[model samples]
Target: MSKILIIEDEAAIRRVLVKILNEENGDYIVEEAEDGLSGIEKLKKDDYDLVLCDIKMPKMDGVEVLEAVKKIKPEIPFVMISGHGDLETAVNTMKMGAYDYISKPPDLNRLLNTVRNALDKKELVQENKRLKKKVSKHFEMIGESESINLVKEMIEKVATTDARVLITGPNGTGKELVAHWLHQKSDRSKKPMIEVNCAAIPSELIESELFGHVKGAFTSAVKDRAGKFEAANGGTIFLDEIGDMSLSAQAKVLRALQENKISRVGSDKDIKVDVRVIAATNKDLQKEIEKGKFREDLYHRLAVILIKVPALNDRREDIPLLIKHFAAKVASEQGTIEKEFTDNAIKLLQEYDWTGNIRELRNVVERLIILGNKEVSEADVKLFASK
Candidate 1:
């Protein structure tokens, strides 16, 4: 059911508005306020999906009410009610965040359409917020060690800038998490963040994968397709395992970085792109450069802000917190009560070599949760958490 509030000074107009809405939809619960002040009081005390506010009222006008409501509950959609003289003011209210406006003696079709559209928009905004929260949880950095804290500080400092970041770390050490945090906290958070794993794509196709290709570019190219760089326009693109990218692809990437433009695989037309590049690799690019496997110039371009993630053994102090977090997450996913890890069990797990880092730790925790008793113990770690 949708909750709507009508703030109209005229009793007859208020009744007619309520009657029209109630007759239009049985699910609408319409509430009335005699003036703008009373409407604001109600808004403060209760939640309403939509507000139909009059432009002129005693004590407070619709513009004032709209401003106050925006400061308080900015998400609620407002549809201003205007008289003949207030048409200009009604349009102005839209610039001030009103969803829309309806003239006095409202048209049935226009009023209903605006109300439905506003509600749909509200629903979309809420869904986006929920999905963003879920994505944040999935990539949450779950440690407080000094090494982790330094990484967090760096993210805060660099996220607002359009700098290219190169993250170096061992596999499974959460380099991808750092990339996600940078994009989510940046000015381009509203735009898409495209990711490409250089090591995963075949060397023969890596160029086309990053720079797109026109139709008939290759034997298998049936249609034109946008590449990672094109898809990430006005946003961030995460290039993982960039050390494994072929030399030819590196040249194209360097050109894109230098010129902010790319030509498709089979086309000569250059396309402009505004993108923030965040690249990560487990292999040491300096060593690759020495061996002639990686370009020296490309390395310099990508490493404007370098962040090295510490190995798990170096941040062992955060293992206990990580265990608790994984335990709750696994239980939630499996629809079971979260089992506790005894102090000794946590200590034992922390002492082991985390060759695979956080990724390995999560797997071990899941195994223990499934095979161990309700409260996992040191013995359980010994029995099931072995390499």
Candidate 2:
């Protein structure tokens, strides 16, 4: 239900306004105040969806009330009431943060309509805020494990500085999550964090994908295109699976890192770029470096700050906490009652070798949610989890 407050100094006008609103829309719960001071007092005491305040009242006026309300609870929509001679005051009140204003001897039609509009607008603003919060939760990192704590500490220390990071871990160990946190918690959080997976893109096209191309530069290139490095200007560019990148591409990447510039294919002009490099790989770079597949110079440049994400097997002590965290997260996403893991079920999970790490664990938890009856038991783990 929507709540509204009227702060007119005249008793007759306040009565007429309340009666019209109450009878006009029984769904609305309306309250009345004879002055701005009383209106502010009511606002502090109660939570109203919308406020209809009058200007030029005793003790305090609508403009003062509007400013105070903005400071305390800015979301509550306030509509001002003004006399014909106070039109300038009303317009000025809006500049001070009033949602809207109505002139004296209120038009019943206009007042009712404005109140409804204000309430609806407020509802939408509130709903958008709630949805954004929900989205932020879906990606929130939930853990205070020793390894997790160390990673957090490292992030706080390294994020504010402009240092190229090399994150190494097994697949699904959340190497990507760490990179994301580094970018988000960094001084460059406001800037975009562009990502390119070297393993996913074809070797022939990886150069073009990273350095862009001019129109007609290649048979498939129909128009001018900007590369990830260009797009990540004044931001961070994440190169995932950098170990899989070809030697030629790695050489070009090294040059870009050394010079802070990139030249597009079939273009002579060098494009200046300012980007923080954060690269990740599941493969052992040292092995790749030995095999002559990865460049040693590029390795040295990118490894200014090395962050190794511990695999799920290595962090078995955190299994129970991770399970509870993932379970609640899964339940919230699926809009279902959270499932509990029996003691035996948890023990069974702890014993299993999580080859795929946290990603595999999340999938396992989701499976239990869908197939397990009541509390997930030891039997469920052996049955559904593919790995």
Per-model TM against the reference: 0.67, 0.64
What lDDT does each candidate get? Answer: 0.95, 0.89
Q: For candidate 1, lDDT tens digit of each residue in 176-261?
A: 99999989877788999999999999999999999999999999899998899999999999999999999999999999999999
> Which pairs clash (backbone N, Cα, C closer than 3 Å) in model 2?
none
Candidate 1 clash figure, as a count: 0
Which regions of candidate 2 are displaced past 4 Å?
1-136
Candidate 1 — what's its lDDT? Answer: 0.95
Model 2 worst lDDT window (10 residues)? 129-138
Against the true structure, candidate 2 reaches a TM-score of: 0.64
| lDDT of model 2, residue 322 | 84
What does the lDDT come to for candidate 2? 0.89
